[model samples]
Target: MKFKISTGACFIFFSGLYSNLLLPAMELQAQNINIPIVSQHNALVLQVDGNKNLSTIYFGKKLLDQAEYNNIPELYKQGTDYTGILNAAYTPSGSRNLLEPAITVTHADGNNSLDLRYVSHTITQVNDDVSLFSVVLKDPVYNFLVTLYYKSYFREDVLEQWSVIENKEKGAVILQKFASANLYLKAGSYWLNQYHGDWAKEMQPEESRLTHGIKTLDSKLGTRTNLFQPSVFMISLDKPASEDEGTVLYGALEYSGNFRTDLELDYQNNLKIISGINNYSSAYTLKPNEVFTTPAFLYTLSFTGKGNASRKLHQWARNYQLLAGKGNRLTLLNNWESTYFDFNENKLAALLKDTKKLGVDMFLLDDGWFANKYPRNDDHAGLGDWQENKQKLPNGIASLVKEANNNGVKFGIWLEPEMVNPKSELYEKHPDWVIKQPGREEYYFRNQLVLDVSNPQVQEFIYGTIDGLLTKNPDLAYIKWDCNAVIYNAYSAHLKNQSHFYIEYMRGLYKVLESIRAKYPKVPMMLCSGGGGRVDYAALQYFTEFWPSDNTDPLERIFIQWEYSYFYPAITSSNHVTDWGKQSLKFRTDVAMMGKLGFDIVVSRLSDHDLQFCKEAIKTYNAIKPKIWQGDQYRLSDPRAGSIASVLYVNEDQSSAVIFNYLVNNRYNEGSKMPVLLKGLDPVKKYTIKEVNLYPGTVSTIDALKVYSGDFLMKAGFNPDVNAERPSVVLEVNEVH
Candidate 1:
């Protein structure tokens, strides 16, 4: 049942279902409470609990925060209560239960749950940092934590990010902010990590807030996902550092999540986990009719140095809330190489054998697996044909799906339904179905033509093709939907005019996606352009992940990805470890872990020593992936400023943090010092720091690690003979809180 906690000045409301119930007291002193409310109405708090707290659900009505769109007020609440209820029956306009706006609460001691739905909960924000609401339920469940944060209306311009201090010994503040506009600044070692794939920051020449860009053979245009505001939300886990030191900051904007059908846009479910210096925040989800109960420890900071500590913390968290917040974890390894050329079953099976052993969870088939004569090796050959290449695989698509499943790995496929090739049977049979200028020469990229999804016939065909594939093979787990070419000679036969085709085409694509998702809700999909070509926020509503770039070089990625992280979630970006590099295995492996760690290089190519190292790297990554993807990201150094150092660390559950430090330059000089102080960790916990790959034998005791209010000395200096280009060190510390 829904529960509301009010203390005259502070109000808390929760909704969701769970089996356990514990009416805990508001145990905090009055001075420690502050609620960040997004609106005056619909500000109720809700929570959901399940067995062992597998997921904690938090939900509430959020008002959209928009400064650019003129129709903000109109769009704010227009659909907040819209239950997709239409003319189902005749009823008075003022009084109708068609919507059934109610909060549901489910509880189970361990396995059995009682669900309670409450339709009446009036919510109001009493002040800027406090809100009050009330809910009535027949029974209540306890032992669940409740919290109230912003769940604002969707905005296209901005993104939110939450960063914690990486120091294992010292308590540091955590920073969160909603970024505004795309402009970036040379802040301290703070950098934002984002999951945006191959899209540029600059607007396309003809691209507007709505349209303009070339369409790919898959009819996937780069112009659709552009952000309304290039701004980012930021939070500081410690005292702010000087903007000058080229301290790169990492942040990301990911577009993949669980979406509900009733809401045209994905149901907004973005939040940040803020933890105090001594405690770590638990991962939770919000359920209906339950209260969002969160302990204060989830959002605390440690101060190593006393320099405007609380101010920094508030600034950080508030900034993240201001920007639209979303996140993702796990970088993926795709099989574009294995399937791109229409390899046979044996070829794929062989390729997957090595990939699975390399610690990769996902194996994505990139094109070429579908169709017979119209092999998808190139864009112009296979557009509308989503059939399997039987000649290459006598066992059919199910065999490959089953084979991958048996190997303990998830299998994914690629498809580009938005376009067609003139030579293909689909386009030849329906010449009027393509989107192009009537008289002008049809644009062809890799011999492909963009499909006019605006046509109901085309949408139906696309849907049927996908439906058939899923029905035929239930083992399909992932898809790498790629858009290879750009829209040239753009026009839609179904549109009233060419001027409206761009937006209309996008809308049609969304419609097709909506239909597809209605049937297949569990499959994960990734958006890929030529490479970071169509990166933006719009596509995020539909897709779960994105490819950062086609370039797999480690050193190059340090910069390429460093730039992209400013407004995306680090988890959505796939980092592939490839042998395409001439650098040392250490450098490459280290760089790969910076993003969602994956392998693209031939694993067999590495030496015995390298192989062992690779295996160890995988183990290390798995142990720390949660922290890297979820903890606050900070850029300790930048190559642009001639400082070849970059560091990212995740708190070690209030005990310590694992740090990946890329020393671009040699720092092997005897007694060379790189005195670094960490933040966002527990000072109360005992910690031991060691450079796992650097000083393998040395360990330092951390006694309440202090935040660096000023410059700190390095532990080591540059090596006398620097390689000029290689990642040097990786640090892993253990906290004993």
Candidate 2:
């Protein structure tokens, strides 16, 4: 192996075997080897020492000149006790470092101490705004190699990193832990912000101060990894982090399976973050010449505050991470919450008629539509059997699609392809397909067993389940893919080593998704893992949007949507108006309009007054849908801290904007007025404000005929009425040409 070092006006190449002997003599030359991975507003500089170990020198705002790299001081300690505190770019399990290791391996000779040193590096400019960098590291005494890859989206100020490990030894080695990226930050007071909740209450924000210890945020549930999302914001505590001011660093792991993120504030006060797949009961064995790759870890730094960090991620996701991201999301009406499993073909047709009358873009026949020997009247009977229930449907899914088209709307169906019920024919025929441990009883969640997707046959079955549905009904317009169970037994019968189940399952799922995407490229699919359980970037790559939660009560959703917008874009969050609570129809409609608008309520049951409100709200939402879908979002007030929640969306050109304010709760003796400051608008432009979606007798706080300058509106925010009778407002702002 050879390594290349580029210094000022000179380049030196050396063989790997002779590096140790020649390094001492050329210490000055080696110290000058700096590789700076730069994005539009941030830079991560890696330096190679005389010992060939890689260390991070700087990671913050962009440095304009190469000389700035040399001016950055490296942290040092003179005593042996503090030697392990040095921030090695990527450390292995060894005595040299006492902190958490990025990769831990036990060799064939029973030696677990392994040291990794820099070998070679390469940089490739994929485009004007994207660059890829890779560094090779290897153990001095073993034939184990790990290659770290970094990709930078310059325009978005986002960076992604992952690692690939290969073993060439004669015997197998046990991989105890493998992390995708290891990031180091200089000494500072820090605050860690994370999202955590369960089931219908997902994405609740929790912030805490970082102290002198290790903080681990992880998800142990194999499938439903959203018990706690693998993402966080580390805010520098010069002061409290707000929307527009303070330094913030954001990180998210792109894995739908079990994940772990570690934030360690070392004894020396510096911080180190290790993030990747969780290593609980998942010690993988890499055989000779075999390789394993980890999921990508994405991160970005924002000096302007947490809001800018969120925008950076949203910009990157819309442009590269999302499927059909540039396309418009449809406004759908679903039947699950309305009728559950009690609806037949005629009932669905009637719903489709109402859906058309309300001007909904599509009618989604969710769940209960597919079954055979065992009817799916409830969640207990039919899951893997993906055929239409003959008694209920009479004709088939094709007939429903035709009915939907005849009603002047599109058709969609819900499917849970990754689960099996014991009473179903598929599970009876192939009992071995379900994940279970031999000679042990299996546990079930939601009356379903997770399919062993790691098996090739299961992968093909999943793909066929989707392909057959779309192929048979060519006019089907959408799909709501859902998973409702977590791995209980956590065993794959087909794999000789059961520890690889989680990673293999994710690989199999992506393979199936890739195949379906290749065949039906235009069909929009929504990811619903029992509602927001599998909300991660890995799944979002193939899905158009995701149901943020099953709890659609507008009051609860105000807090949920506020927390969700911290990292995810509105276009990818599916919000629905359901008959779950007593909130007014207008209030529910206004809340749902903040995201991909949809309805999950029985339209025929609504009062005439409510029906008209729905019609007007949908029309108003469609008028400003373009700006809401592709725009910058500003969160004005946090719902968790108070009774009022406010959000604003501004178009790229600042020509149009929308503001939503909700009085989540009302208390006696409190004022019925809330101030909402607008953001992301052109300060010099004159704009007109209109209160939309109002009932015939309802009153609004805004004077629709009055015009205001952007400067005045932002400086002196307008107040909206927040009484018990009318608790929400949706204001439209357009530049006065």
Candidate 3:
């Protein structure tokens, strides 16, 4: 058999014997081949030995020349490990390999061992910026096949990998464990950076040093999978991790269901990373001729530190994963915090008027507009019934949409279709629609039960719910799709075996989302699982932005946004000003402007001075929205390290920039003066800096007329006057013509 390898415009062919069993060691030695998947800045080289065993030979900075591959074997010679454990590219359970396997299966005839050997390979150029390389492997003893796929985003320095496992045996094969990708790195002292938080507080960065054991980050919440984000950064301690100067390896799983990422530092100092769907209570049974594919694991290797790695991932996401891409996101006013559940048509009309008066782009009617029988007056009832409450809306949702549009403001609504409260009309009619184990009492979370999305009927119902809303009101500008509860008593009556609940549920959710996206392609949607719960690439592909946290307090948001920016771009982060904290209006607006700016406060209730400040802040945010959404982000200071946090954003052409400085707390005797160093600016360009969005009586921090060279601003950074009264400032820098 001939295997064709294509690296860019170059192609090579090599001959190998096709077999169902492992070839003899001597015969296989001559057929060994090295495959290199090259990106713009990195290369991942895989070696298939004569015995058909595949392993990673090298994965790091790009090779200068193809000839450099010849020395890799000699540089890292094979060891004498008789147990057949040498960082096999895609390890399977069996063959005396003791390390964690990427795949574990129980085959027919009660045989549970699997030893996959390389069968064939192919490479295809997907586009100018992307390429796909696939390798097929099969267990010599069983009619089982596993195809590993690697897709390289060449220009973005990002690689995505996933596995497809097919069962060709007569009887059903049970798959106990399956990982999307496995990577092995040479022994080194490494530090792992991960994000951990709860519902109202998400994306809190935590760093730890790796030791000689297994370190795992996983989430089994089933639905709100991001309680522990399915992403991490590993940096070598040799070159300490900094914003822009270190070797950083980032891996993020695209799955939104139960997921796990394991980092193992073995006795030999070798490191292994296994990331994909969590195997806890999710053993899938594959029938004859059936195939199961894992979610894609996205990764990038950066030699220039966490910032570079983040930019690469962000570029790739905008190019492919995110639905909104680099487009502008709308700034809206969400009414959840404004009115909670007590509002009528007159109240909503007043909010709509405020939305237009305040120059907000959209007015969102959140949570209380739905349901007729149960009234939806609080969190306890009216979840599953997707209808307008006559008492609240009076004239219905179409009227509200018309009113907002007539006022030159867009309209949006919120729906939690994947959840149903026990007091809801839909739940009362169909109790079996929820996920509950047979003959067991159901567990309630937030007074609601998780809809059995794994059931086809439930999927259809969810699709219909959104479809009805969009169809009835075509002018509805946005949607806030929420899933407020996690799966409990997880059992899928639609499935014969209950172990497939998590995987099937995710599949079902995706199916509904796909259907919706296909129809309402232009409608922008926001994914919110009580805030940051559904923050994964799989869901982001369909939504425009996400609520980073339910805690809209400016101080808490400073930390949340800082950590979130390390992976997700600002365009996808929906930050809103609220009345939840003691921060002043200017402080709240300055913090929210760092991301896609919005508001969740009752505008009419604001003091006259504060109301005028909101109008001016909205105007300023609109003027600089492009720089914040599409510019390169530089985190100048970390809130965790000090009492102040700062961030800078510079446009692509270096024509414009914005800096946000936030003071977390007031120090009694110390002066509130700190240097704000800039990054990603043209050293030769002279720019004018001005403080924007200042309240009527607030003190100014910038001259608003002085021009300074970028080099001077970066080297001799300017000091901002951040005091207790004015705890934050937004500096706008425009290149002087």
Top of the candidates by lDDT: 3
TM-score of each: 0.58, 0.94, 0.94
Model 2 clash pairs are none
Question: Residue by residue across 4-59, what tens digits does model 3's lDDT show?
Answer: 11121121211132212222223455656877899998999988887888888788
lDDT for model 1 comes to: 0.44
Q: The CA-based lDDT of model 2 is what?
A: 0.82
By lDDT: ranked, best first: 3, 2, 1
Alpha-carbon shift of residue 209 in model 1 (angstroms) = 23
Q: What tens-digit string does per-residue lDDT give for candidate 1 at 301-349?
A: 1222112222232233323321112343434455554345757788778
**Model 2 alpha-carbon miss at residue 661, Å:** 0.9
Identify the runs in model 1 with alpha carbons over 4 angstroms from their true place: 1-333, 338-342, 665-677, 682-685, 693-726
Better of 1 and 3 by TM-score: 3
In model 2, the worst 10-residue window by lDDT is: 1-10
